[model samples]
Target: MNTPQSMMLGWGSLVVAAGVSFYYAKKTINERRAVQESMGQRPSEKLDCASFLLFLHCL
Candidate 1:
C-alpha cells in the first residue's frame, strides 16, 4: 500500500516538472522571437524549435 502511494507521488511530481519545463521553454522562445523581431532581425523559427528540443534532452 505504501509503495504504490509513494510511486504514484513520484510520478506525479515528475509529470508536473515536465509540464512546467515545457511551459517555460515556450515562454522563453516567444520572448526571444519578439525581441529579435523588434530589433529588425528575421527570427528563425527552426532555431527556436531546435532549442526547445535540446532543452528537453538536457533535462
Candidate 2:
C-alpha cells in the first residue's frame, strides 16, 4: 500500500506532467497558428472522432 509520502510523490509527478503538457500544447498551437498565417491558409483538420477511434483500436 502507498504511504502518505508515496501518495504525495505521485501527485507531484502528475502535476509536473500536466504542466509540461500544457506548456508544449500552448507552444505548438502558437507555432501552428504562425505558420498558417504566413501560408495564408487555415490549419487543416485531418482527423475526426471515427478515425481517432480506429487508431485506438489499431493499437
lDDT scores of the candidates, listed in order: 0.89, 0.93
Off by over 4 Å in 2: 43-59
Q: Write the per-residue lDDT of candidate 1 for residues 1-59, one digit (tens) a residue.
A: 56998999999999999999999999999898889988989655556788989989999
- Tens digits of per-residue lDDT for model 2, 1-59: 99999999999999999999999999999999889978979745668899999999999
Best by lDDT: 2
All candidates' TM-scores?
0.62, 0.64
Q: Name the lDDT value of residue 31 in candidate 1.
A: 95
The segments of candidate 1 whose C-alpha lies over 4 angstroms from its true place after superposition are 43-59
| lDDT for residue 21 in candidate 2, whole number 0-100 | 100
